[model samples]
Target: MITGLRYLNHSDALFTGKVPHQLGSLTNLQYLDLSWHYNRPPYRNVDNIDWLSNLSSLQYLDMSGINLTKVDIFNAITKLSSLSVLHLSNCNLKSIPVVLPYVNLTYLSTIDISENDVSSMIPNWLLGMHNLVSYNGISTDISKLIRDLSGCARYSLQRLKFHNNLLHGKLPDGLAMFSNLTELHAYNNFLSGCIPESIGSLSSSLMYLYLANNRLEDPIPEAVGELSELVVLDLSFNPLGGLISNSHFAKMTKLEAIFLSSSSVTVNMSSDWTPHFQLKNIRMGSCVLGPEFPTWLKAQRNKCLMQAFQLLYLTGFGTYLLKLST
Candidate 1:
């Protein structure tokens, strides 16, 4: 009556060949983990996961780094009605089943399918899972993914990470619907267009927002300063150009890290205006923050990163280890 089974704890121990079919016989197993070390090798192959249908009580399943190339993954897990969390990252999944007859996984909340070969739009049933709280890594149409998630899990979803997916599209205004979102990571994609002004609607809840290394070319919305709870804000390496003023950070009292390097954006705050939050790290390389060096830099007693030209403006700024970017 083993209720939990966790494998791959010892790095030297490698389970080769197929996943033990006997695992499905653990009818009372609530948790089963057979994730392998991704950096080593993926040898635990599962040509057929139909065996999983026997574990009706399975609530948590992690088969990451396993070769699931021959299995219809979505169809294999649909019957696990009690499933709450599922991790199948880097499983070499070749295709994703787009439609399911019905989804019995009413309690399913978190799923990570990152680093897979499934280059398709997210399945409708996956988005329709109202109880889903966090989703990570999947290649999909950015616009449709946002629209579907906003339509289905608007209030339930909290964390979303889909960076480095080569996704192209504007972040739709529909993103503003996820009021409960605390972290949104969509960096390193091919995304274009301006960040929607409606994103300010998540002011009370969003804590981490990363959108760096994209092709966005518009000025950041002044409404972004409305993110009162935001702890980190990154909008670097884009072609964005705009005059950023104090009003753009009027309510971000919780922000601790800000990254805007390699952008055309300019910071034009008043000489005497003090930031509401003290940053631990601030990067502004290739940005325009000059003329008379704003006195606000004196209060930011942390590591400062900027271009070599801006260093000439620093006279009496104390406690700043300047890291000049070439």
Candidate 2:
């Protein structure tokens, strides 16, 4: 008799059975996930809690792929004080569970417990979360997640995702006080430094900024071309070098996408740098695009209105392909 389960983790079954012994009458359950869908049915069920203390109107508590061990899931998620959103990505979580502020859920925002075996500090009681916008997975202290997101700047965050893991150092000095941060996904990790000339104070309705790969070297400054309503800018690979030009993004014109493959592998474009390499989703493969590369991809389809592209592996461009697909 599974009673009234509002939400049972591991994606609703596939190694799911326990925690169903009449689910303690559900008590008008709000949301309770036992966790497992590390991407669906990843299989993680050993001695289930069987009824989860008869959940008392749970808010949203994903057990986060429970392998248990961290004192048996933070002592049963601190007795679930109406949890809001807590998915500890991979189990094996090391720290950061200080009873989570007696979790009244208080309308919690988002918290993904990334990869696992967490470490690197960053549990300042989640800055007393006043409806946090995001507390992206795992630890590995990237300066304590920028000092708990610079005090979570009044928590009006728009978007934030800490991609990959192993976040090392650099790029976290108050992060412009989250002036209503739009999006900042710290890719890969092992973060070296650079790319923070106050990052232009971001938030011009900022749209996606990922520091790809890591070990960030020099060049990528120019205050990120003044982020004019920037839209998707991933600094590929790292080892940053010169000519990190943007010429002020040719007035940005609401740039769609632009990822400089090898920041500086040989790329020496100088036809007056041509209107600041106008973009509509470009990956700039191997740099050095001197030759008649379709006259610079038909001059980026003569400026805008281009649609969808990937343009992978460049270099003396062969096995050609550049179908702007209308």
Per-residue error (Å), model 2, residue 117: 32
The local distance difference test score of each candidate is 0.81, 0.62
Give the alpha carbon lDDT tens digit for every residue of 116-152 in model 2: 7766565656566667776676656666666665665
Off by over 4 Å in 1: 1-13, 137-140, 291-293, 302-309, 318-326
Residue 276 C-alpha lDDT in model 2: 38
Candidate 1 residue pairs that clash: none
Question: Which residue runs does candidate 2 get wrong by more than 4 Å?
Answer: 1-15, 21-33, 38-60, 63-81, 86-105, 111-132, 135-155, 158-178, 182-223, 227-232, 235-258, 261-286, 289-326
Per-residue lDDT value at 107 in model 1:
95
Candidate 2 worst ten-residue window by lDDT: 305-314
Number of colliding residue pairs in each model: 0, 3
